[model samples]
Target: MSLFWKESDERGHPSLGTVMRGVVLLAFLLGGWLPSSWANQVWEFVDGEGVTHIGNVPPSAATRGVIWLSRVPPASVVKGKDRGPSALQFPGYDDVKQHLEAAAVAQSLDPAFVIAVAAAESAFNVKAVSRKGALGLMQVMPATAERYGVAARPSSDGEHAAMEPKVNAQIGTRYLADLLRMFDGDKELALAAYNAGEGAVIKYGRRIPPYPETQQYVEKVMRFYRGLLR
Candidate 1:
């Protein structure tokens, strides 16, 4: 399962500065960054030992110790609610980019594609738990993990195993690759299968299922995937 790995000191990895820049750029795209038209308010606040969370929708009411980072134009609320952990939870791309790249490459997937999926699924929250019992960075269900041979161990239970960032990335990307193959390399169909189910995709004659969430998920991830590659 440990494939597509590079040395920790691998040359040519993007620098921290580059990662930060990329994070901001990706955040802008995801959060609907407007140019010369308006500014979105991403509130920043510190908690327990100075961990700061910058969020378009602040965790709570803004008060002292809450800060906002503005870039040109007047501050305004950004449209759309974000998934758990939000975009700002990722302080920089460096935090998760390498894992995304490694897992994607391991599964013969485009790194940006994997990243886009992760962005949509959990927003890089390694501990994210969905209401439907999906868990971890990739929001992997324990059953899915079992099917993929990365099922959680009995000692740690399936939940904790899926919570591991690297494990989740690997298993999740592998599952995505499986979906792609099942759909004959059609990314849209593959994504639909990933979000909805292989059964749903097939029931719909290999077209993206008509479910609103699945359709929106496919489009959003594709947008990020294409934008990042460009």
Candidate 2:
């Protein structure tokens, strides 16, 4: 009844892992039915022994519990990337407030929007980490970081560049500016695209995505932005 043929544990036959790898290779060669994004087409599932597999094919391990693909966009490729901050530093809201304001000014946006986003995203927490792997005050995703030229600090003690307040504010503000421009200065649509994905916005006819989380996120951020105005 298994989606994948089982391997005998006692006899040590080729494992379900091995079988799935072969199938994945074949699928790679065929390339027609598989999701063709460079985002790894990753499917994660835990095996009976609690071993996790992230690859193109799902094995019998999927029966244990949940299995799903992480459709995060592939990191944009660039040749000869510039070096990130060689020496990283951590600063709190008070110390970094001026930088945030400067970044917003450079982007020709209201400082309140940046402050509100940072507040809504991480409550100004310097070390915040999202379940979806977003890091720092702006909760920048790796793909989004890559798009906005944010990088991990070279000397960080396990902290990403996005977790560094100054860097995150700068890059995140630039990203918001780009989104606003893309949506033709529509704050609602831009915020929606920021919460969901630009592709999702386009898919939904240039409106907010249908997901409840994103809808609420837009509203919450707007509320925060408004409160900052007063």
Which candidate comes out best when scored by TM-score? 1
In order, candidate lDDTs are 0.58, 0.56
lDDT of 2 by residue, 70-121 (tens): 2212122236432221011112457657767888999999998887666545
Worst 10-residue lDDT window for candidate 1 reads 2-11
Question: Given candidate 2, what's the lDDT at residue 74?
Answer: 16
Q: Which stretches of candidate 2 lie over 4 Å from their true place?
A: 1-95, 153-156
Q: What are the runs in model 1 whose C-alpha is more than 4 Å off?
A: 1-92, 154-159
Q: Report residue 74 deviation for candidate 1 (angstroms).
A: 17
Q: For candidate 2, what is the lDDT? A: 0.56
Instruction: Give the range of the ten consecutive residues with the poorest summed lDDT in model 2.
Output: 82-91
List, residue by residue over 1-230, the lDDT tens digit for candidate 1: 11111110011111111212213432323222334333334333333332323344323332333322322111222355222222223443567778888999988888878987886565566666654567667777778877877766665344557678888898889989989999889999988887777888999888988775577567656655654554
Error of 2 at 200 (Å): 0.9
Clashes of each: 0, 0
